[model samples]
Each structure stands twice: as structure tokens, then as C-alpha cells.
Target: MIVSGMSGSGKSVALNTLEDLGFYCVDNLPADLLPEFVRRVMRGEDRPEKLAVGLDVRSGGDLGVIPDVLSEVGGLGLDPKLLFFDAEDDVLLRRYADTRRRHPLSHLGLALADAIALERQALKPLRQIADVVLDTSALNVHKLRRLVITEFGLGEASTLSLLFESFAYRRGVPPDADFVFDARCLPNPHWDARLRPLSGRDKDVSDYLEAQPDVVQFAGEIAQFLDTWLPRLQSDTRSYVTVAFGCTGGRHRSVYLAERLARHARERGWAEVAVHHRELD
Candidate 1:
């Protein structure tokens, strides 16, 4: 496992969280030494079943070397996962002020904002390579820890955790979604003046949508498609899958369909189905 991100984006907190989850944790290992480090871990007299390493700008690591090293490790049959943490610039600035700590790049005589900008540029390569990019702008340490535990903890080891999310097509697709379904062709509730101010979760909006035969049929067909294929998908090594439903406004059709799918999955004995209404959030 590799943990990297912006300077104040909680890499240390992530490492501590992993340590609590029984992973052997290392901090600030140089990028050039990663290959040799992997070798040692694999062939050492005492090998840990799980290991996590932290890397950031302070490690004197060359960003250009990471892809090659990762390829080499992959050649050796290691399935390494990278986690990138990030936050909004203003949030990062606030964190630095609260902690009263100088930025790592401040030694170059750059201002705080400039230092942060430089760090972000330097870490862009790692961010592109990450399997998970966690945004921490609104998360406190405790919340982040809980999120890490929920995402990485082995409690649901045999089950595939499913996330059904609703989004607006105007906002583009969700980056992490495994399957994206378009609902713009469905009858929209936005045109209904009575339901204009209500969300899909509201009783009035739900009633309006439920009364539409086309909407009902769309939901049923999508649910059927998932039921037919989810088992095959679960047979793969992935632990989680995200199914996104998108409409023009995300206020009615998309949200209703996403909720309906979540319920269907649960009824089918999927114990870890979750619904996320992105626009609502």
C-alpha cells in the first residue's frame, strides 16, 4: 500500500489508521528505495501480511520514477494499491494556520500559497496513479478514521460492498463509478411546478415518479440487469462497486432510481448496499 497526497491532507492520519488496522507502516521512504524495500519485505525472514508506506514531497522522491518502479513491482506479481488524499486549497491553508506549522517547501523562501501550489504540482503524478482519491476538505480526523475503517476493514470480507449514487448529467460523470446509467430520457419531475422545490426522496416527488409507467419500467429493467450480472461481478477480486444513476437535474428520476436499486440489492441479500445522492449531499 502507498499513501501520498497534499502536504496537509492527512497522510500521517491515514498511516496511523492503517497501523490500527494491523498493517506494518513506514513513513517517508524515498522513491528510489521502493523496489529494494519491496524485495526485502517479500523475502525477509519475518514478513508482514499487510504493509503500508507513506510518501510525500519531503521524501526527496522523484515523481517520474514511480511509474517504472510500480511496473517493476507489478512484474514481480505484487498488486500494490495507492491511496491519494487531498483537500481544497482554502481548507489546507486553514489547517496550516490552525496547526501553526510551516510548509515543507517554505525553505525555498516561497510563501505558504506558493509552497502549496508547488507541492500539488509535484504530487500530480502520484494522484493520477492512485486507486482511491479521498477528498478531506470536510472530514475531521475522527470522521476520516471512521471512513478508512469502513472502507478497508475486513468485516465484509466475503461480500461486495455496493454503492448506488445519483448525480446530474450537467456535472459530468462520477470518476469512481463502475457503471453509469443515464436517466435523462426518462420523464423528469423538474417540469412539474408542484414538485420543483422537492427532491426525489420527498413523498410528493416519489408519488409523481411512481405514477409514471415509463419510470417504473426503467427502474425494473435496470434492477433486473444488475441482478443478472452482480453475482458475476462479485466473483472478481474487487471489494466494492459503484453504480451511478444520472439525470438532467438529479432531483427526481436519478435519485429515485438509485434508491430503488439500493433497495433491490438489499432485498437480493446484498448486506452492504449504500445509497449516495450526490446532488442532495
Candidate 2:
């Protein structure tokens, strides 16, 4: 598996998490060396069963070389998977804040937000070719761990879910999402204090909000959009796709919504869906 993501979006944490879960993890590796790296592993030069590596901007102009690298390894009889973790600007900023680490581009003395935006641009190619896109803006390590376990077939939700979550800044985002979103334009759930703390999972919250014509209308629109969107993702012949949910605090509406959405998708005959509340806690 190739663990790719933005510099501050838990790429390091996920590397360690994968190792804890038994992946022979390699970090910030030279992208040009991947094909040979696998060669070494297959020859018993490294751990065999589970292997993961980190790839991102540190590779410089060679950053775009990964897809070729992965393609080269394809005929080797391994169905290699590319897993990426990406989050919104603010969430990434918060993570950087909590960790107090410097962005790889900080040497330019550029504002953190701008640096992240630029980095996203640099990583767009990989995102387009990725088998999975995890938006981690609101996902916490615990939620992320659960997602990793569930989606990867290592947790209680054994069926495995290639789950992905979309979120909004006006709304909270998920802390454990493999994918995340910034939907500030959708609507704002923060105006109402009562609904502010309640997630989409609560009956009262759903009822109160759905009672509003706008909420019902928007829900239908988003649901329809995803129905078309998700199937395209699944048809890609890739391993899996996981979609997550997010709101302003991840505590109230988004969490509740994600749970219900997961259930809805499951009932509709989508294998099994795993739900995670990234910012709920």
C-alpha cells in the first residue's frame, strides 16, 4: 500500500499506525526507488505480508513519478493499492497547531494556509489517480484508527468499507476520515446553539433540521449527487473507497448525518458501510 498525503495531514501518524497494525512501514522514501524497494521485499530483504510507504512533496520534481512507479510494479503479481489522506485547510492548520511542527514549505516563510494550498496543488495528480481519497479535516486519531481498521478489514466491521466523507467549514469536519471536504457554502449549522452541539445522529437533531424545508431539499440534492458519485468510485476496479461525514464541530449535525448516511447506503445494497464521527469528540 502507498500511504500518500499532505505533509501535516497525519501522514506520519498513519505511517506509525500502519506499523502498529503490522505493516512494514517506510517513511518519506525516494519515489524513484519504489519498484526496487518492492523487489527487495519480495526477495525477503524486508517484511513481506504487509508493506506501506510514504510519498509526498519531499520527493521534489520527482513527485509526479509515483504513478509510473506504481504501474511498473503492477505486473509483479501484487495488486498494489494507493491510499491517501487529505484534509481541509483549517483542519490541516489545526493539526499543525496541535503538533507545533513546521510545514515542509515553511522555509519559504509563506503563510501556513498558502503553503498548504500550494501543496495541495502539487499533490493533485496523485489524488486524481489514487484508489482512495480520505479527507481528514475533522478526523481524530481514534476515529482515524477505527476507519483504518474498518476500511482495511482489520476491525470489527469486518466486511470492509472504502468509506469517504465530505464536510464543510461552516460545519464541523471529521477527525478520522480518509477523505474530507469543505462545504461551507452548503449551509451553516452553527447559527442555532441547540443544533450546534447535537450531531446528525440524534433523532431530535434530524427531526428539528429536517423539519426545515431547506434541510430536506439539500439532503435530497446531496444524496442524489452521491448516488452517482459513489458508483463511479466503486467501478474503478480499485480495492475500496471510504467516504466520511463532517459538519462545523463534528459533534452535532455532521456526526449524526454520517451515521444515517452510512445506514442508508448499506440498506441500498452497497456492501457494508462504516460510519465515523471525525470531530464528534
Candidate 3:
């Protein structure tokens, strides 16, 4: 469990970063009120895999409640760590001003600066008790992302991170793809004048593309290649993968080929499948 600090302190960003690292997140929880919820979630269901939460003053200001929650966690035999995010009031103030937002504590008729100071004071007890404390004033987005990836071990991933991407020639490339192939060799139905505007999912288009022996062979080869190399790729612990398949247009041949490969991967019990048709719409 992570009980994050003040609003405008990048708590949400931290929480979301953890979520991407595969932590299920619960937000803005009161510290005093966490035992029952934690007990229920942890009991009768085993470890429930992994989970995280953001407990803070928006729910209640008594930091002492955290110790009780920790005690409950110890009693329940679930060790939950508390990470706190901190920043200079000036940095946080600038963040809020730059984003044109108000502090969560400001809703109580307090000035922004006053609210920040009050929140800091309220959370002081929690900070004294934190497992890892971060001063985010100097951490930009990249640094913050790295911190979450490093400290919580959330960013640790297997070597073979399979990325299935779909792209349009006009929109640039998929941001997270490991391997890319150009399916442009398959006959493009787009230039047929009649089929030019249709997508691969259309019955006529699917039939036409499926009729091409070359296209079937190409897809089969690609799938077979991935199967052989992916295991070794995993052994190396590669962080991300991107595969791009291009054609004259992204709609017909490339989409058909991509989907076919995806189906093959799924049938083989490979669930790390993500497919996008960059221009198929």
C-alpha cells in the first residue's frame, strides 16, 4: 500500500505509473479507514496477486492512523509498503499554476499556499514513517517514470516484451513496437478502384487477400520466425518491442496479415497479443 502525499504533488502521476507497472490502484483513501478494506481484499482470496493504494489527507489528516493500518496489515500478515511523494511548495505551486488547477485542500476556503502548508503538516507524520521518500521538485517526467520503475520494482519486465502495433504511413510509427514487418508486398486491394476505400474486414477484401498464396506464406513465415526468436528475446529481458507492417495503404493487406498473425499467436496460447490496423478504418 502506498499512501501518497499532498495534492499537486504528482500523487496521481505516481499512482498511474504504478498501475502501468501492474499494480492495481485505489486512490484518495483515508488512512484510518483502510483496515477493513485491506482485510477483506487480502483474506479468503490468497494474496490477491499485487495491489496498491493512495491514502492521504483528502480522506483524513491523522497520520497516526497509518500505524494502526500497518499494525492491522502485520496482524493480517500482509506487508504493505508506504511511499510518499514530496516537493517544494514553490514547485508544486508552479505545477498547479502551470496546469491551471486548484489544490484539493483549497476547496475548504483556504488560500493555495496555506492549504499546501497545512497538508504538509498533516502528512509530516506519514513522511517520518515512509519507506521511500521522493522529493519530486527536481524530477521531470522521465525521471519520475524511472523512479517508479526502479524503487517499487514496478518497471521490471521480462526480456521479451512483445509489442504488436498497427500504423498508418501518414501518422508516424507506433510508439511501442518491438518488431515491424512490411506487408506491402501482398496485393493491395486499395488500388482496385472498386475496393480502394474498403478495409480488410470486408468479405470481398478478406477473400481477395486470402486467395493470395504468397500472402498466406508470408504471414506463416513471420509467425514461425517470432516463435523461434521470442523465447531467446525473453531470455535477454528486452524492455519493449515494436513491429511495423506497411503497405501502399494500411487498410487491406497489412491489416489482414496482422490479424492473421495475431490469431495464430493466440491459438498457440500466447496471450501477449496486441494488434492495431494503422490505416484499416
lDDT per model vs. reference: 0.83, 0.68, 0.71
Q: Which candidate is the best by TM-score?
A: 3
- The residue pairs found clashing in candidate 1 are none
Give the Cα error of residue 262 in candidate 2, in Å: 31
- For residues 134-153, write the lDDT of model 2, one tens digit per residue: 87777655456556666777
Model 3 worst lDDT run, 10 consecutive residues = 155-164
Q: What lDDT is reached at residue 131 by model 3?
A: 93
Candidate ranking (lDDT, best to worst):
1, 3, 2
* Better TM-score candidate (2, 3): 3
Compared with the true structure, model 3 gives a TM-score of 0.56
- Give the top-scoring candidate (lDDT): 1
User: For model 1, what is the C-alpha lDDT against the true structure?
Assistant: 0.83
| CA lDDT, candidate 2, residue 8 | 65
Q: Give the TM-scores of the predictions, in the order they appear.
A: 0.55, 0.55, 0.56
User: After aligning candidate 1 to the native by TM-score, how far in Å is the CA of 190 from where it should be?
Assistant: 62
Candidate 3, residue 156: how far the Cα is off, in Å: 3.8
* Residues 1-281 of candidate 3: C-alpha lDDT, one tens digit per residue: 67588776667767766665567789977777678777777666555577788988887657777877788777877788888889999998877774567677877999888999999998888898899888889864434655666776654444233434455555555544557787766777877888877777677888888788988788889989978887676677654444667666567776776677767766876534445554542
Task: Assess candidate 2 and give its lDDT.
Answer: 0.68
TM-score of 2: 0.55
